[model samples]
Target: MDEAGLIERTKNPATRESLRRDLEGMGIGAGDVVLVHCSLRSLGWVSGGPVAVIQALLDAVGIAGTIAMPAHSAGLTDPANWGQPPVPPAWIEIIRSSMPAYEPATTPTSNMGAVAEIFRTWPKARRSAHPATSMTAWGRQEDEITARHDLGDPLGPTSPSGALYRSNAKILLIGVGFNRCTALHLAEHIRWPDRPSVREGAPILVDGERQWVEFEVPQIMDDDEFLPVGDAALASGVAISGNVALAPCIIAGMPQLVDFAVDHWRAAKHPATPR
Candidate 1:
């Protein structure tokens, strides 16, 4: 919606303080680690836009807490998989050879939205090393959460998803639905350990030098595929729903959510098996 429409719907602008209150009401509290996915527009007109939204999250989490967001650089992926605006087959090799290496300090997030893009550059934020599926985090546990990101298992046990799961973090969805949840990808990995594999390449720093590297990773599924599992979570009360400003929101424990998705998908895959 346009700014004018957002302003009209918002009634009162969402300032950092107000947003923090809403977040706390939704169960975000001090010392809690959270993986957030948000759309600034979905919150209606904010007093400080994405900045305010992020600050409020920080305020709710406090100094003892941590906040993390997907800083995925999908553009760094193999050009051969480019479908939104596919490049000519002949140009793929040229693009691969010339593409700039993924630099966590400068690489911009693709389609992750304004809030995440801002969080990626937030002061003291630590980003994972994965060239494509890196996650950025801030606050107390930032280092521990972003320390290791396995190239072959970008969302699996060695990635930030695993760290967050181990930490029992919360997944906060603002102005977005289950389809935007990245934590669910971890469930996919668990449910289909032998899922199909695909070759992916990207320019990344190796021994402090830029080089094009290739690796085999489990084929990533479309985000929409998580919708059914997410819906099921809400239906089963695994996730709590509320609102921040005019935007709909959901908060759930990351481990619970992932475990639920694994079971949900398993049941779907094996209809006769009791959940």
Candidate 2:
């Protein structure tokens, strides 16, 4: 939104300390492994924008805690599926063949927002190696959280999502919803009766040459059905609700969400659901 629109809607200016105070009050504490999805626009006018938000999150979790965010660089993926101003049909192949190799230090997050884009570049941050759907982390557990990102199952049991689940992590959504949760993708990967996979490719450096690599990942059609589960979680109080700075927030155990969602999905007999 434009500056004027932002000011008109978000009248308060939140600070790092204020944000930290709010987050801690909501139950995040020292040594927690938390995945965050925030919207700066929703936070109103922050004193330092994303920088302040990051500082608050780090402070809320303490030195021993870990913080993560989706760092997906989707532009590196197959241009054939592109939308939101997709490339011309004639230029798809040419662009895909020449796109720059995914570099952890240089690539930017597409559609995740300013907070994530800035957090991934923090001095102590470490990002997963997945070219198209990487996750970035900062803090004591950064290394473990970002390690071994499987190229094929970007959001499955082998990627950062799995790592977080195995470690009993938490997810904190600030002015966002389950549709962007990502942890739900892990639940989808463990289909009871098995599921199909989708083929995709991304540019990566191999043997000192940048090449487009093709692979099939578990087919995760959509999150259109995520609302019911999310609503249940919130209404049942399993997913805690509160405020971070000025924006509404939701916090929940990653495993609990996945388990709940898995049961809901399987019982629904909607084979097309989840991962």
Candidate 3:
């Protein structure tokens, strides 16, 4: 929104203090590990933009808590399978050969959003090394949460998202909804342990050299398909809604949301299938 319109709705510029207060009011407090999926535009003019929003999250969680966000880097993916905007057939090999190795500290995130894109670059932030589905984290368990990420199980139990669930993290969706929620992927992993796989490749440093490695990963479906599950979750009152600096926010426990989604998906996919 324009500056005047944003100020009108927010009553003032969004400041670190204001954002912090809003987050606390929305039930985020000290010692709460949170996985955030946010849209900077939906946040309605944060005073310092994504920077202030990140700070507010840190402040809300305090010194004892941790915060995490998806730091996926699509550019690191195998170029041979680029369908959305596939490259020329002849350029596939060139792109694959020239792509840089995924570096936890230097590689840029694909398109996680302005907030996450910036948060991943925080000086002290730690990131997993999954190349395709890496996650960046801060605070208490930053290392523990993003320590180990296997390419084959990008969203499974060993992935950062899974670690968050095991840690009983809270999911905070800012100006977004279930479509942007990463926690639900954990449900997919649990719900379909033997789900079909897709070929994926990325450049990684192995033996001190950039090698294009390929593997098969559970084919994580589109987010649009998750709408029904999220709608049901909202109807069941699992997702609590509140405001944060003129933006709508959804908060729910990571495990609860994942469990709720898995049950809903199981029932929907197989009506007569026993739980």
Candidate 4:
């Protein structure tokens, strides 16, 4: 929103302290592992913008805690799959050939919002090696969380989401929804082990040389497909709802939510089958 509109809607400028208090109220605390999906605009006007929000998260979690955010470079995907304002057919080859290799320190996130863009560059933050679906993490356990990102299983058992699940991390939706939750993709992988695969390509460094590589990954449902599961999560008391700043927020145990979604999807897929 415009600056004037944000100021008018926000009762007070959201500062680091206030944001930290709000986060703590939502049950985030020291040594907690949180996977955050946020929209800065939804938080209203802030004193320091994304910087303040990131600091507040750090303050809430303390040095013992760990924080992670999806740093996906979606634009690096094969241009052949581009849909939103798809490039001309003739330009596809040129686009793919010229696209820069994904570098953990230099590549920018696409459509991941301002908070994540800044968080990826935060000091001491470590990012996964996946060319298209890498995740960036900071604080304690950062290395463990971002250590093993497989090209063919970007959101599967070996990716950052898997690490978060293994660590019993909390999925924090700040001014966002479950559709933006990367954790749900893990559920999809678990529930559809035999799901069809899609061939995807990205530019990556191989032995210090840039090359476009192709790999097979399980096909995933669209973001909107997760909405029903999210609604069920809230209705079934799996997700705790609250507010941070002027934006609505929700926090849930990553494992609980993923398990709930798996069951929810299973029921829909096999309504007549006995559990």
Candidate 3 C-alpha lDDT tens digits along 47-156: 78899999999999999999999998877888787888988999988988998999887898878988888999897999999998899999999999998999898989
- How much lDDT does each candidate structure score? 0.90, 0.85, 0.86, 0.92
Tens-digit per-residue lDDT, 1-275, candidate 2: 77688777765778999898888987899899999999888788888989999999999889889999999887888888777678799998898888999999999899999999999899979999999899999988888889898788798888999889987889999998888888878887764426777788899989978988998867674766577778878887779899876688899999998887777776775444534
Q: What tens-digit string does per-residue lDDT give for candidate 1 at 250-269?
A: 99999999999888877775
Worst ten in a row by lDDT for model 1? 266-275
Give the clashing pairs for model 4: none
**Winning model by lDDT:** 4
| Poorest lDDT segment (10 consecutive residues) of candidate 2 | 266-275
Candidate 3: stretches off by over 4 Å:
1-10, 269-275
- For model 1, name the residue pairs that clash: none
Candidate 4's clash total is 0
- Model 4, stretches more than 4 Å misplaced? 269-275
Cα error, candidate 4, residue 148 (Å): 0.6
Pairs that clash in candidate 3: none
Model 4 TM-score relative to the real fold: 0.97
- Number of residue pairs clashing in candidate 2, backbone atoms closer than 3 angstroms, sequence gap of 3 or more or interchain: 1
Model 1, runs deviating above 4 Å: 269-275
Specify the highest-TM-score model's number. 4
